[model samples]
Target: MTDMPDNIVMPFEIKPLGVRGRIVRLGAVVDDILHKHDYPAPVSALLAEAVALTAMLGASLKFDGKFILQTNSDGPVDLLVADFSSPSGIRGYARFDADMVAALKEPTPQALLGKGHLAMTIDQGQGMERYQGIVALGGVSLTEAALGYFQQSEQIPTRLRLAAGALAQRGLRPEAWRAGAIMVQHLPRDGGISPQPFDSGDAPEGSKEEVTEDDHWVKARLLLDTVEDHELLDPMLTPEELLYRLYHEDGVTVYPAVTLERHCTCSRDKVGDLLKSFSDDDRAHMNSNGVIDVTCEFCSTHYQFAPEEVEPAPEARAQAQ
Candidate 1:
């Protein structure tokens, strides 16, 4: 097998394409986001891609912000989420039925999601409108659906490459699994036309400008379609090496490697606040004698709070606040 490289920002470039084109580089952090959740095979795989896609897209945002990817489905896989910050902090979660997930084999987003929408939320963090896009979860894998969204919605030539296969756990976590992914996007340009992916001629020409665009789109499309599954999931390929291997001939300038890790923000007190959201009647029903148990699905952090712990919402009440 070909060796891969370590985790880093990999490299990216933001310059003019034919006249004014933009590009981005995404690395393996996508896999890291999925490790925090004990997702079913297919669910985890899609979530990992969503996470990587979010990070990759967020990396290209013009302002300071975060990108959130979420889904509300009705299949064995109930919910999936991925969050990425501008500087590139990645986090994700997947919720599914224990019994059903183990026996799951569905890969189609429609089959896995039943009926739902794919939402992308961007928080500028400065009181901006916080861009949000919601589209039907239509068709096969999320990778294909997301690429479609980029084309029709965001109006960008984007490629989302993901690897959500199982990874050998470290230390005593033997049976555990990990995921990885990478995203590449060609941002929109002023003119309706962008550089042709692979054209070996000076003053690129076609039947017409539209024809040139179609040709350009086709050339790039072919190159992206050629990306193999091995290139995406291989840990040894490091972000830099992967880019150089794939786009070197096309003249890609990698930026720098970005560090990534898995994070869970659940807390005991936070769980209590969630329980408080329910009405007194609802809370009372969930309570058995006194203890109200709350478990975070992402990290499996269990928090138990007695009935007495549920109190009025006072800034001073640790749980209420």
Candidate 2:
């Protein structure tokens, strides 16, 4: 909709600094996803960040595929799943123990996710190979974890920032969840730059070496660090304006932006097929009264199926007989 231009991913490059980047901002699209589940504020915020990051990474796919971002941890908020389908569909949901979340002393990102791993998966449709990269979440923010994924898995020097919160006008409207993210990767003319290696404390003494970052990358990273949470989440600020504010000194070039929307892939037929895949015992356990109720986690859509509707033809015939 022309009235809602906030949901978009803009790709850009800073030629002088040899850095390529993407900026993702979600307004109504994220709000709808968050509203579908009455999750706690902290959980919603985390999910918002996950969704924004998914969009940024998914937009880079050169083919028609899906990008999935998931986290499994031992914290109050244990699981988060967000997926971006090619051509601009994004949806995500979060799972958490409300009681555990309420018991937290401070709902910091670390406290919410505890010690777990973050996984980034790329699915290039059926028959195509799926690629996944995982990074440990110990003692690091989500942004840092993603950076580590790129550093170790892709060996690319990367910097990222993510922010999400509820924004509202004082009197006109209620608060709505919004998210924004910016990521930059070094792409020097010399092919690709290797990221510095981690210092393994177990390494034999003197095996450690100091690796210096390129000056241009250092400048770009410093500029990225200067970004504030509000600057990223501000609906009033266009992506172009923010890019100019961040990299006008080096001359930033932006390509056409890709629009994003809230789209759930779940359908009645799909759910029915999934239910039918379960064993008879499983399906019997799931049955309630005379119907089977199904709720989509992503969109909170509810569907009801008659027993015969989801049962295999042989099983249905046997039962009828």
Candidate 3:
């Protein structure tokens, strides 16, 4: 593993094979976002997984825009949202029925989201049409659901392992939360090749010298399964080290890393502009105690605006024409 800080996405490719993967470990950034809301353990865990997924998927894209992952269901967790901005920024939030969640001893992803669909959206800024893919949530964990989406929507062989939890240290006043995930994908190769013999000694017994595509994919998946939950979430484990530990036998090569940060697009000016769309009467009705307070759900940032600030000035309106 390269010597660097956490909160980064490291890309790697298996040499001589059409396979690619990424490892992401998030620390302070995830802790910052989750701390804004008072969520139960189950809800917090789900949201952390969402955030990690967002970072992994977003980093894989080459677009300079935004990627969003969301789920809506009738279960205790009504909504889960995570968005990643271009370059490297991620934020996530969840809404759940407190009483219902509290009643359960342990809640799984499927239980929290009883019946719902997972949606992924990519927005490439103005003049470009946004793309979205939806798949039914059939898996028990978020990682499985994501793998299902890749299989059904893109027909790509993919594997993902995600883990999140609070880390307790001796002198820390409060436990620090962290989330991490690793993803591996098999890219299509041109033309067909004979089934090649395995030299790693990990392949199935009596395998033919000519290896088929399925054989390669199966080998990659098997290697991925060897990764333990602790290895992925441990802050001490660097991405390079983790990848080496998993795919060293397969010959892994690390690419440049992308750093991630916690950021919210919401701001006072943006909120003010949204309120300006309303008429004077509507704006007046929205005011409370002569001030309109808007709180961002993703980051819990509060923006207050006086009625006058929301109303466009005469000079500004005249300049618009």
Candidate 4:
């Protein structure tokens, strides 16, 4: 097996076709996040896809902000949360019932998720309005749900493919989890393609211009449809090589890739502050054997705090000292 490079998100465009897209290849970063949770195989696979999707969408932010992808469902896997911070920080976690997962003979990712709604939110930091889109999820994969979101919410013609699995050396135990995704959007410079319908109310009385899909976009999407799951997950093939295979006829131009890493924004101090937010009676019940234990779902970092430490503000305790 060829050695795969570290995680990265590469931006590329088929200029001749008026289409732009991003390709993300995740390696150790994704492996670490999945292994940290020790989730069952099906759950891990689903979460990995969510991570890849989150990274692809978050990388498009022009400002220093955050993009969050969350899903609430009525399946074995009840919830999935993944967020990407500005530039290249990504973290994710999944909530599932182990017994229900194990009881399944074989479960596809969509089956594991059952029925739910997927929500994507963008936070432009403090003092800025947030934008969010929600789409119902059932009888479809997460990729399809995301496409529906873009179609209904952004009204943009988009195509996306995602893959994730455990890769191991020949005749050995599975060592790592990897995920990859590619997304393409139709964006014509001359505004030739409008996904929205023509507004008859605003049109001139005698005008009869009807909107239709652009040929370039149709060709670009057809080309993207040729991508295979193995190609996306193949460590041997670089993102550039994959893009060439798909868009070489149209001459693909690539921009600098954005390196990504796994990072959790959890800390002892933060957990302590969270504990202090509870009322005195609540804190009392939480003080089990003289200490309260908190574990971060994203990173699985464990923290412990004393009751008195959280009761009074640190500054007030210092004054009393």
Candidate 5:
């Protein structure tokens, strides 16, 4: 494992098998987003997982746009959203019933989001039509749900491992949050080039036999299953090192790394524009203490606007004139 300087998304491929993968390590960026909200450990950890998954999956897009992962459910946690903008910007937030969440001893994804639907949306900027795919959340972990989405929605064979937690270091005011994820996919091959046969000899005991493409997928998944939570969340482990630790025998080839950062696109002007769309009466109803206060859900940034500061719509302006 090489020493990576900071938050990065590293892409890699195992030669001759058409298997591609990505490893993402988020450090200060995740800490920045999660620290803004005083979320319970489970809520914070789940949101961190979403953020890491967004970065991993978002690296595949060839367009300059935004990728959003969200879930809506009837359980204690009703809403969760994570966004990845083109060229490596990410932010996320979650909403839940505080009392209900506090009572959960082990808040797995399913427990937090009972009967929920996970959705992935791609917005290719203005004028381009957005694309979305939805799947029922039925897996033990968010990683498994994501893999199911790709298999059922995109018809791609995918495997993922994700982890998030806080790390304690001596002088920090609060423990820093860290998140990491690894994803591998078998891209459809052309011309019938057989998948590079993998020998199961290196696999741990009690592993299933491998013979065909499906068997190869099983082998890959088994390898992924060997990853531990600590390995994923460890700040010192570089992507290269982690990949080598897992697939060094298979011979891993890593590509250039992409840096990631915590960024929120919300601005006072955007909030004002949204407020301008409301009818005069509606805006008046939203005002408190003679001013309207708006908070961005993604970043919790507060914006204050007096009625005069929000430019009225053209029709409203014409009527006023």
Candidate 6:
């Protein structure tokens, strides 16, 4: 096997503003997620974007833990979950109907997701309190909803664009998929908790304070407004070059990349444990005749445990042991 760079989570920092961050690029991991199911083209694309966005946001977590971004909707494409952290990874499946087809017209994010809630969950690993932010979904796709979440809930100034599909010449159903994304956020210019800068820049357009924080904010906003989806999503452009193109003069600090892999928290024993949540009748039915095989919907990993191996944990033995 050829050498592989260590996929360690090396956090990237903005030197000038003293603002720090991290970015996880998804590749091998994304394919594993997509292989879990035969999702419609549009649905798969949404999950890919979800993977990048979640990793991007999760990298900003300050402590050792996992950040989960979940999209739960009442639409045809129902659920999307992305897990992110040091061993930063992505594995998730969409709830596409059996009749779904890949040949359908592509959909805007909101249309594909339908009415839903976007929730960001932060688990700090230690005894620290876990935090969650839930915002009403907005915008045409996952990118738009994420933008709304950042602005309305976290109040952090952020911009994100993502795209997912097979390599152009490879066709849409290729075993290897390519997904790309770019994330940008305005560093805390004043300070992490400093007061807003652009409060009164609207002073008659001629007042000295017209160059207030508002003016700076306006300028920043205008700069981001010029970014196109193609630039962020294109696989041909290198990530650093993409940044230079967007913020060359604005002083963006490039950080080392973290490799995103395919990992899932599912196991046969774990699945059995979950089965314990069901009634005995259900469990009996599940293992009535022979082995019950489980293929995780996230990574398509197949697991089989014979009926004899599916027994419930013994409460008394647990206490004694």
Best by TM-score: 2
Off by over 4 Å in 2: 1-4, 170-173, 194-203, 315-321
**What is the total number of backbone clashes in candidate 3?**
8
Please identify model 3 stretches exceeding 4 Å from their true place: 1-4, 170-173, 188-213, 279-282, 312-321
Candidate 3's TM-score reads: 0.87
TM-score of each: 0.75, 0.93, 0.87, 0.90, 0.88, 0.78
- Residue 24 in model 2: lDDT: 93
Q: Count the backbone clashes (under 3 Å) in each candidate.
A: 17, 0, 8, 0, 1, 5
Residue-by-residue lDDT tens digits, candidate 5, 67-186: 999998887778889999989899999998999898888788778887878899999999999999888865346877787787667666677889999998666545899999988877
Of 1 and 2, the candidate ahead on TM-score is 2
Error of 2 at 124 (Å): 1.0
Kindly list the per-residue Cα lDDT of model 1 for residues 1-78, writing each as its tens digit. 663444334546433332112222233454445555555567766676566666656655667678888887676667
Model 6 misplaced stretches (Cα beyond 4 Å)? 1-24, 98-106, 126-128, 169-175, 192-213, 313-321
lDDT of 2 by residue, 110-156 (tens): 88999999999999999999999999987677888898898778878
TM-score of 5: 0.88
User: Which candidate number would show the highest lDDT if scored against the true structure?
Assistant: 2
List candidate 5 stretches off by more than 4 Å: 1-3, 138-140, 188-212, 311-321
| lDDT of residue 285 for candidate 2 | 88
The lDDT for every candidate, in the order shown, is 0.60, 0.90, 0.83, 0.88, 0.83, 0.63
Question: Candidates 5 and 6: which is better by lDDT?
Answer: 5
Q: Residue 44 of model 4: what lDDT?
A: 92
User: lDDT by residue for model 4 over 2-46, one digit each (tens)?
Assistant: 665559999998888888899999988898899888799899999
Over 4 Å off in model 4, which ranges? 1-4, 170-173, 194-212, 314-321
Please write out the lDDT profile of model 6 over residues 27-130, one tens digit for every residue: 55676677677776677778877887776776666567898888787666767788886555556666765343333364667666778798888888878888
- lDDT of candidate 3 over 85-150, digit per residue (tens): 989989999999999897766688888877788899998999999999887764356887787777
Tell me how far the alpha carbon of residue 240 in candidate 2 is from the true structure, in angstroms, after superposition: 0.9
Q: For model 1, what is the error of residue 178's alpha carbon versus the real structure, in angstroms, after optimal superposition?
A: 4.6
